[model samples]
Structure formats: C-alpha cells, structure tokens
Target chain A: MSFVDMLLRAEARHRSRLCVGLDPDPARLPGRWRGRVEHLYDFCAAIVDATADLVCAYKPQIAYFAAHGAEAQLERLMAHIRVVAPEVPIILDAKRGDIGSTAEQYAKEAFERYGADAVTLSPFMGFDSVEPYLRYPGKGVFLLCRTSNPGGDDLQAQRLADVPGQPRLYEHIAALAQGPWNRHGQMGLVVGATYPQEIERVRAIAPTVPLLIPGVGAQGGDAATTVRAGWRGDAAGHTTGPVIVNSSRAILYASTGDDFATAARAEAERTRAALWV
Target chain B: MSFVDMLLRAEARHRSRLCVGLDPDPARLPGRWRGRVEHLYDFCAAIVDATADLVCAYKPQIAYFAAHGAEAQLERLMAHIRVVAPEVPIILDAKRGDIGSTAEQYAKEAFERYGADAVTLSPFMGFDSVEPYLRYPGKGVFLLCRTSNPGGDDLQAQRLADVPGQPRLYEHIAALAQGPWNRHGQMGLVVGATYPQEIERVRAIAPTVPLLIPGVGAQGGDAATTVRAGWRGDAAGHTTGPVIVNSSRAILYASTGDDFATAARAEAERTRAALWV
Candidate 1:
C-alpha cells in the first residue's frame, strides 16, 4: 500500500491522529533504565506495547538510538513495533540529506535495514536527495516545512522572489510536494503543530497531502488549533486530508517510575483525545 | 583549536588541500572484500593508511556504513583514522538536521560517539539544529550551501525577496555563516566544486570561513577551478580562507583489484596534485 493509504488506514482503525514519538533519551529513561543504553529496545518496546492501539503511527527518532551505538537495539525495537502494532506505520525520524549514491544508501538504511514505513528527510539538498528514497515504491518522505523551532524562521519563513506569488520558502516546498513531487503521492510535509497558522497555510497550499505535525503536547502547541488548521475530513469524518500530530517527550517521559509504560499509555490516550477534538 | 585552525594546520602539514572521502560501497569494494559489509572498516582503514599523509582531511560518508548496519565499523574506522592520521581532521558527512533535544542526540552521535572533528549539516531546519553541535566547543559544522547535485537548484538557488538584495538561499547562508551565526569562528559552508561560479560567490560572501568543497573527482567537479574559486591564503602561504576539496568514488574505486589500496594512494596523489594546481 502507498504510505498515505496506510496512514489513513491506521487513523481509521485507531480513530486517532496521534503519533507517539519514540525518542528514548538515555538520561531520561525511567527507573532502572535511566542512563542505560542496553534497555533502549526494552523501554521503547514497552511503550509501543502500551500505546499500540492508541496511535495512528509511531515515530522512532534514530539519532537517540544511534547516539548510544544501539542501532541493533533499534532494529529490535522496529521489529517489536511491527509485531505489536501490525497495522500502525513506523516513521523513522532520520532527517538525512545527501546527494546521489549517498542518498541511496540512507534510503536503504531507513527502509531496508530498519523497516521504516516512512522516513523524514531534510529537503535542503533538493530532489536528488529525495529521489533515491521515492524509489521504495510505497514508503513516504516528510520534508520539513514550517518547523516549531524559532530558528526555523531563519530560512523557512523567508519570502522567495521570482516564484510567481512570492511564496515563503515553506509554502514553495508545499506547492512543489503537492504538484511536481507528488507523482507517486508518496510525499508529505512536516509542519509544526506549534505553528497552527503556518499549518493552515501549508494545508491551503497542499490540500490532499498528509501533514506530520510534531510539537502537540510538550512543545506548547495547542492541539485543537492544530487539528482545525491542518486536518480535513468528509462529513462522515472519514479523512479527506491526513494529519499525524506527534508527541515525543510528553508521552515518553510521562513518568520516570517502573509504571512508566502505563503513564505513557495514559498520555497517549489523552493526546489522541485532544487531537481528535 | 577551532576546526578551521585544525583544517589549516592539516593543510599546511600535508601540503595539499584534498580531502579523501571514505565512502566504501560494498558492491564496489576491491577484490576479496567485494560485497562484504564486515570489511567496511578494513577497506576504509586501508585507504586511510595508504593516503593519510597525502591529504588534509578524511570524510567518511555515514550513509555508506549505516546502510549495511555497520555503524560499529564506522566507529572503528573513525578510531583508525585518528590513530593513523591524527593530524588530518575527519569530517563526518552525516548532513543531519533536527530540532532541540533530537538535534542534541545527533550531535552526540557525531562528535562524542564517532569522535568526528567536524560534521556536515543540512541547514533546512535552521540554526536550532546547528546550535546543539556548536555547544561542543572546538568542534566544527559545515552547513550545506550550494551542493553539486542538480536538484540543489530547487530550493538553494532560489532568491529571497524579503531579504535585502534578494540574496539566493545559498548566498544568504554564506552571509550568515560569515556573520552572526559564526560567533565562535567554528562554522563553514559546503559548496560543491562542480559549480565553480557559485563557489566563487560563496567565497566572496564568506571570505575567511573554511569551505568544504566536495564533488571534485568522480562527480565531475574540476579541482583547479574549485581551488581558484574557494581557496585563499596570505603571502607566506599560511591560511587566510581555507578549503578542503573532497573526492570519494574515484579514489575509493580507482582499482577494483587486489592492489586497491595502492591504487587509492595513487588516485589521492593525483587528486591532491590537481587541487594544488
């Protein structure tokens, strides 16, 4: 299946757009797992088990695992996600950007080695960097659009001259992804939930493409506003345009006790409810 | 010492500006090592041993290693580079870009775990993604400016209307790297060698920051043009504006035979001589 179709299916099955981000910080691991790299798969798998039915997708930040030299454990966590949440898609949050053959290798690492359903990429290197990943027929690539960080304004918000309407950089990227780049409908944009206005703008530019909005819970973004701006549905509530509102730190670090998984489930449930609203 | 200082010291010590990119592809590995992921470290280390004294830096494309689940081998190769050629700086061609804590984890992966002297970053997410790496003093980051790939024109070559003079995206990055964003004098720009005019433009905008120019050999970028456009120095032949010209596939696969390392050295020597000219 195409990744968008898979995302919509997960959304329908779970009845939610919440994507629990699995960013396992070693310093922040719960209880005995704290500061221990060995428990990366264990902690992430437990969280996956707890929230498997509560989310549309799971985003595993590869850097967190790679930083600890625990890629094999990440491989295990990815497999664990597959077994636990068979229908839910996995977005490997590896914002990789390179050219030509190097890009091909990164695509392989994300799709072949890690079994990611979708992977994030920095669109800075343009379509050559993106083209390699698209060769993986059904996999998706999320280009960073209006990100949540203040520094995002440095480049993303700047107006592009000579492009007919003088669109902002993010708007231009949205238009490209919606038009020329969406030949396979396997492309998406990552617009921050914190920027609900920009989310609305991006939605206006790329109406049908899915939007992966992070920063809903812990990054001080208003969930209801984000959903209103980015999410689109038919009268029967079937998705017309998809949205994946991701919450990482808020869900993963909900509790630093042995019952951390349970706390994470509660957080995921609450986040899903909030995104639904 | 700052990364630029280290780059300059290495350049002067080696008497060449060439940076051999250690992008070891298993499919193209020489002779007995062909198509063997287990030999990633062995192939790269052999190349380093052969060319250590002939170059200013060694850049290992992480994607090549990560694709085969050989990040451990990458760690070992990094250690090998440090041991065999301690004077030559190592640039981790990760091109990683993310936000907040996620970006911090990526930085730790590059600087701490991998022991990279410098890292390449895609500036798509802006300064927040770059800031975490900057936190580690003495480390360096080379922002992707005007890449050699054709698709780079998609976003990088666009003009920013709102900004004064309507600077192209890459030129705006050059100004920032040469100005406010480079407070610690630790930032550089990655301008591809294929576009010598753009390299010259970047040099004009950021006269003193080190420029990591890739796309030299196998990618069809001219070494002499790249050198003339990007590199600058004072009368004593001491560094003023530094440049590290990179060539990957041409050097790594110069000979797909038993004497690959020796062939690699010859290619490195020819490339180094070309850059010097």
Candidate 2:
C-alpha cells in the first residue's frame, strides 16, 4: 500500500494519531532492561504489546542501537516488534543523507534490511541523496524541516536573496520539497512540535505533505497545541490526512519501575487521547 | 597543537597547498589490490607512500570503505595511512551530523576509533552537532557549505526574513560560523570548486578559516582557478594559508594498470604542478 493509504488505514484501525518513538537510549533504559539485549528485546516487546492498539506506527532511531554495536541485535529486536505488533508500521528513523551510490546502500539497509514502512532523511545532501529511497513503491521519506533545537535558527533562519521572497531556510526547504521531487505523496516533513508557528507555516505551504511532528512530551511541547497547529487548516481541514504525532522519551521513559510497559501504555493512551481534543 | 597551527605548519613544511583525497572505489582499484580488507590496506598504504611528501593532508571518504561493511577495517586502513604518511593529516570525509549525544558518539568513532586528524560534518544538525567533535584539542571539523551538486540550489536558495537582507543559505551559514563558533580555530568549510563567487563571498567573511576545496580534477573543478581564488587580497596578493585541494577519483583512478601507484603519484604531481599556474 502507498504510505498515505497505509497511514489512513492505520489511523482508522488504531483510532489515534500517536506514533511511539523507540529511541532506546542505553543510559536511560530501565534497570531491568540494562546490560542485556534480551532484556531490551523483552522491554520493547512488552511495550509494543501494550501500546500497539493505541498507536499508528513505531519509530526506532538507529543511532541509539548502533552505539552499542547492536545492529544485528536490533535487527532481531525489530523482528520481535513485528511479531508482537504485526499490524503497526515501523519507521526506521535514521536521518541519513549521502551522495547517490551510498544513498542507495542506505536505502537497502533501511528498507530491505530492517523492513521499515518509512525512513527519515536529512536533505543536506540535496534531492539526489533522497531520490533513491523514494524509489521504493510504498515507503515514506520524512525530510528534516524546522527542528526543535534552540540553535536551529542558526542556519535554518538564514535568507537567500536568489529566491526573491519567502525568507527562512526551513520555509525554502518546505517549498521545494512539496513538488516534483516528492511526487509520490509518500514524502513527509519533520516539523518539531515545539515550533507551532513554523509548523503552521509549513503546513500552509505543503498542505498535502504529511508532517511527522516530534518533540511532543519530553520536549515540553503540548500534544493538544501541536495537533491544532498541525491539523488545523491542514488542506481544507481534511484533518486526518497529513500529520503523525511522535513522542519518544515521554512514553518510553515513563517509569523506572518494573511496570515500565504498563507506564508506557498509559502514557501512550494519554497521548493518543489528546488527539481528539 | 590547534588545527589552525597544524595547517600553518603543514603549509610551511610542505611548501605546497595540496590535500589528496583517498576514495578507493573497488572497481577502480588496480589488479593487484582488487578485493578484501588486506588489498584495501595495501592500496591505501601505497598511495600514502607515493604522495605523502607533496601533500598537507590525506582525506579518506568513509563511504567507500563503509559500503563494503569495512567499518571495522577503517582502523587497519588508518593505521596503514598513518604509518606511510604520519606527518600528513588524515581527514575522514564522513559528513556526519546528528543530535549532541549522537554527535559525541560519532566524534568518538572518528577521533578515538579511526584516529582521523579531522572529520567533515553536515551543518543541518546546527552547531550543537559540531561541538562534540570540536571539543578535542587538535582535531578539525569541516562543515559542508556550497556543495558541488546540481540540485543544491533547491532549499539552499531559500530567503529568510528574520536575518534581514536575505543571503543565500551558505553565506548565512558562513557569517554565523565565522564568529562565536570559532572554537580552537579548528573549524573549516567545504566550499565546492564549482561555486567560485560563493567561495569568494564566504572567504571574505571567514578569511582566517581554512577551506577544504573538493571537485577539482574528477568533478570538473579546475585547480588553477581554485588556487587563484584561495589567494587572499593582501598587499602582495599572497596567501600564506593553504586551501586544501582535493582530487579523489582523478588521483586514485589515474590508471587501472598494474603500476597504479606510480600513475597515481604522477597524477598527484601533475595536480600539484597546476597550482603554480
């Protein structure tokens, strides 16, 4: 299925816009899940078991696993996630962007190796860096737009006179990404929830383009505000089409207690409930 | 010593401004050094031995090695390069950029694991992404600016209103990077040879910053024009500083013949000789 159609189906089935971000930070992992890949697997499996019904997708940031040389182990973990939550989509969040040939290799790794439904991309290497990944029939490529970091404005706010009007670098990226480069309707923008105004601005321009909204909970971005900024005026208020709300630490690190999976599920439930408001 | 001081010292010692790029494509390797990690080691060692005397630094683009699942083999290759060309700096041309924590891990891998003198970074992650790599005293961080790709103008050409008087994205990056972020003087920018005007504009603002100019021989960028562009407008129109000229495929693939090292050295010599024009 196309990313849009899959997203629509998943949202309808789950009845939620929430997408849990599985940024498995080793340092922050619960005590029971520490020092063992098996434990990590169990923790992730339990979380998936508890929250799959509440979320449309799961995002696993690759860096956290690769830090521990857990590439092969994480492959196993993802397999377990698939078995546990067979219906939910997996977004392998590796913000990779490189020259042409190398990008093809990365595409193979993300889609063929991990079997992810979508992959995040860093557009710094230009469209050629992303084109190979977009070649996959139904896979989604979420390009980095206005990020949540305080220093984001450092380069992102820079204006180019060559384009005549429309300042901010992020706006420029949004403008170009909406067109010929991303024709499949599978392309998405990562608009941080912390920057509601910019989210609204990006949403205005790239109306059909799905926005992967991160920074919702642990980053102090209110979920309700983010949904409004993202879904409001989103292409004639066809509210369901173009936004997937993401929460990482807030859900994953809900408790250091052994009932961590239960805590994670509650956080996911609360986050999912916020979508209706 | 600081990276700037190292560059100055290299310029004085070598009496040349050349930095050779080591991008070993398997298809381009000579018959003798065709496959396996051992072949890569021998090939890289030969290049280092042949050209170390005439160059300021040697850059090994990590992608070429990394594509072969040779991530572990990089240490061995770096060892070979260092043994052959100890004094000449080694810049691992991995354009890595991520969040602060992830950047720290990449820094560890580049500095601690591979022992590269410098590493390239993508500025998309903001200054925080560059900080971890810059924290080390003697290491260099080359930020991507004005890339050599054709589709580079898409988002890089966006104009932002907040910065007042919209500058092309690269110019704005150069302006911000010039001042507060000039930690240890280890910062350099990757200005492609194709954009001479942008190069001049960036150079005027960041006069002290060293530049790693790629796209010379193989990528159709002329060395003579680049050298002339590197000349700071002093009273004598002389630049004591060196602009690291990079030639990857042109040097590495000088010949598919058995005496590839000899041909490679000849190419390096011819490339260096062109700077005088």
Candidate 2 structure quality by residue, lDDT tens digits, B1-277 = 6666666676667766778887766666788566554566567768878887778788887766644555555678788776776667788887877776667767877887778888888888688878888889888888887777776666554544556665667766676667787787788888888867777777887777788898899889888888777556468776534588888888888888788889989998888888644
Q: Score the docking of each candidate (DockQ).
A: 0.90, 0.38
How close is chain B to the truth by TM-score, in each candidate? 0.97, 0.93
Instruction: Give the clashing residue pairs of candidate 1, or none.
Output: none
lDDT of 2 by residue, A1-277 (tens): 7766777777879888899988766566787566564455566666778898898888887766555545665677689777877777788887877766667767877887778889888888688888989889989999988888776767766655556574567777787678766767778888888878889888877777878988899888888888888775435645534579999888988997887888999999999999755
Q: Please provide TM-scores computed only on chain A for all of the candidate models, following their numbering.
A: 0.97, 0.94
Top DockQ prediction, candidate number: 1
Error of 1 at A26 (Å): 1.2
What part of the reference interface contacts, as a 0 to 1 fraction, does candidate 1 reproduce? 0.92
TM-scores for the candidates: 0.98, 0.88
Candidate 1 lDDT over residue span B130-154, tens digit each? 9999998999899999987889899
